[model samples]
Target: MKDEIVVITGANSGIGKAAAIKFAAEGYTVIMACRNLELSRETQKEIIAVSNNDQVKLMELDTASFASIRTFCSAFKSQYDKLDILIHNAAYMNHGEKYRLSPDNIELTFATNVFGPYLITTLLLDDLKKSKNPRILHACSNIIKHFFDPKRKIDFDQLQGQKKDSKRHSVYKNYCASKMALLMVTFKMADVYQNDGVKVNALQINGAKMSKATLRKVKPHWRIIARIQNLYFPSPSVMAQHYFDICTSDKFETITGKLIDHKQKMMQQPPSHNPNVITQIKQITGSKVYPAYAANPEIQEKLWELCNSLTNKNMVTPSSEQHA
Candidate 1:
């Protein structure tokens, strides 16, 4: 593990910071990809001091911006040769009802939670492939199952907040939709890269205490309740232990395309698996979000084509073909 490399997004605080510390202590060269340079540097210093691991580093990365993602990826490739683990831990949750847009003009929640991770993973696929056992862990949400309504499906027409009059416009619903979409992609990627030796999985850090910075984003009325609830939650360090186990332990060596709960139990099936629903999601997002067991090759191909066109980056060809 001394030479292993791990990249964690949103590493300035909360779960990402804890995971970085854990990985660094275990002798991995941990890179904290964050949006705030100053905060990330401070956290980097803290991790190095605590773990006594000088290999810990920081890089500026804004998941909400495609340009930033591209820049970060280029810098990473120029500096590093291998990436053993990629943890998609960054997320954004708007407290108000109004919708927000990213620099790329996409809905901010979707841009941060879904599109960013999708693009980053594909962009870094080559580096990940260089590792003997590369793993991609998505920090998904348990709120997806709790909030998902079985009767209602994703409305692709309103995916980009194009229909202002749409009734389902609350921030809570938007967040849930983003998380649901992420889960779908998680399953799809696990299948797509399984043969290539990249393992993909999603997990939720259930019952973990959120950082004060996150709680401050909550509305004042709810913030009090949240603070009280947080008192009973486990520390981020405990949650990091679970993440570290999933990433490195021999117990998960053969596990690939599964949704593991906070307790490390595998969920038999995701919340929703309707082909029509999945297809509609793919059509709108230009990405496939479905379980590996139920994947449609035709749809996946089209989604991939759309992604390459949208990002102006060709990922269909093997990395060796382009880099060799």
Candidate 2:
């Protein structure tokens, strides 16, 4: 693992920060892609100071923006010859009254949790492939379970969130939809890149009650149950240990497209593996991704067609960093 090079998104604070610090401590080159430059720099200093690791570096990447990803990837490709690990650790939970759009006019939650990782991963797939043991880990939440009601219909008509009707929906609904989309994509990606030795997986850190500061930021309203859970769950650092295991764990080196539990091998949530659920996810993603890139006839038929038409690029090739 020490021989590997790693990049993490949303490392300015919270879980991302913990992952960066732990990865760096293990001697992996940790690139903290943050939206804020000054904060990222300060974080880099702080991480280095504690870990005493000089291999850690900080790069600015506003995961909410496609342009930022392109620029960051371009510069990263120029500097490093290979990328071993990529953790889609950064995510935005929609808690507001309205749906937010990113610079590219995509829904804020959708753009950050779904498109950001997809665009970056597709763009950098070649670099990830260059590694001897490449792995991509996506940070997802159990909170997504709350949104898994089969009774409700999943919406795929508005892939870009161009419509404003969603403004009426609760922020929690929006957040759940985006996460489910991300997990579905991971299932698709794992199948696509498995043959290439790139193990793509998603995991839940459960609750980090010990992280008083960060926990408050994510869930401000604490009821009795929330408070009780906080007392029993692991701290950010302890939970990060599981994340660290996933990033560099040899146990899952051969396992791809799995929904890991606290960094361990486990079955996915019932809905995650349901054939019907898979069908719905494909419909939502326009079939751009299949269970595997090699298989899933619909993925080749629909998603490929739509993604190229939408992005107006070479669909799934390595993306260059595009900046203003």
Candidate 3:
């Protein structure tokens, strides 16, 4: 991991912060992409103290806004020559409250969990290509099944948060929607870039400690609700070790376009990984991507266009070339 130039979004705390420290321990030059300056500084100190890796630096990144992502990417390119690994670990889920709006006027949940990481990856594709066995690990969740609907569409317009007049909608459902969009997006990207050596895959990492991000957003009085909500919080650092293993795992150098769960690399089954779903996602995400089991160029194109429109980012395209 020492030689790896790794960048992790929302790296100041929780799973992301833990992953940064672990990577630093393994000798990787880690860029902690975060939104808060003071907090990021504090986290850097803590990480440096624990790992003694001064190579760790904070890069301001707020994935919800394209402007923020552009700044982070440009600043990163100015100093670093290449990116060996990119972990799309930072995610957004505002529980115990109604959905919020991002700076870009999009739903906060969609912006943070889906749009932010998607744009950053597209902007950093060239840098990732510079690595020998470049890997892209997307932080999905086991909670995705929580959002599964037999009537769901890969290109469903409402999945991007146009909900209204529905009191039945819960944070749990919305969070899963965000991750499902991401999962589909990962496949789109993997299809385009897997052959380029920049392998992009998603993982269901459960049992991580509560993220400070989680702390920051929760309403003051909602702590009780939050605790009850998080009945089974896992160790953030331990789960981050799984992230570290994936980012640093030599065994996965050639592995892409697969969903990894708790160290088990398994094939995504029907309906979820169906060609129709991939098609919808590609059209929505603006990437001609496909699943390993069923690669279809036509469907990939349709999904990409839809994705591009929803996010309002020009990075609606991807190339699956496994390289470096």
The CA root-mean-square deviation of candidate 3, after full C-alpha superposition on the true structure, stands at: 7.7
TM-score of 1: 0.84
In the range 20-44, model 3's lDDT, one tens digit per residue, is 9899988899999998888789889
Worst 10 residues of 2 by lDDT: 287-296
Best candidate, TM-score-wise?
1
TM-scores of the candidates are 0.84, 0.81, 0.80
Q: In candidate 1, what are the lDDT values of residues 1-324, reduced to their tens digit?
A: 499999999988988999999999999999999999976787899999999999998988999888888778877887889899999999988666576678876777878887888888998999999998899998887666532234544444554558555555777777876776677677779888988899898885565787888898789988888899899988888878878988898888889877787678776543344447765554333221223322335544544444445556523323332223
Candidate closer to the true structure by lDDT (higher is better), 1 or 2 = 1
Q: Judged by TM-score relative to the true structure, which candidate is superior, 1 or 3?
A: 1
Q: Provide the lDDT at 268 for model 1.
A: 56
Q: What is the lDDT of candidate 1?
A: 0.77
Cα lDDT listed for each candidate: 0.77, 0.71, 0.72
How high is the lDDT of residue 179 in model 3? 74
The number of residue pairs in model 2 that clash at the backbone is 10
Model 3 lDDT, residue 269, Cα: 49
Off by over 4 Å in 2: 165-167, 210-229, 269-324
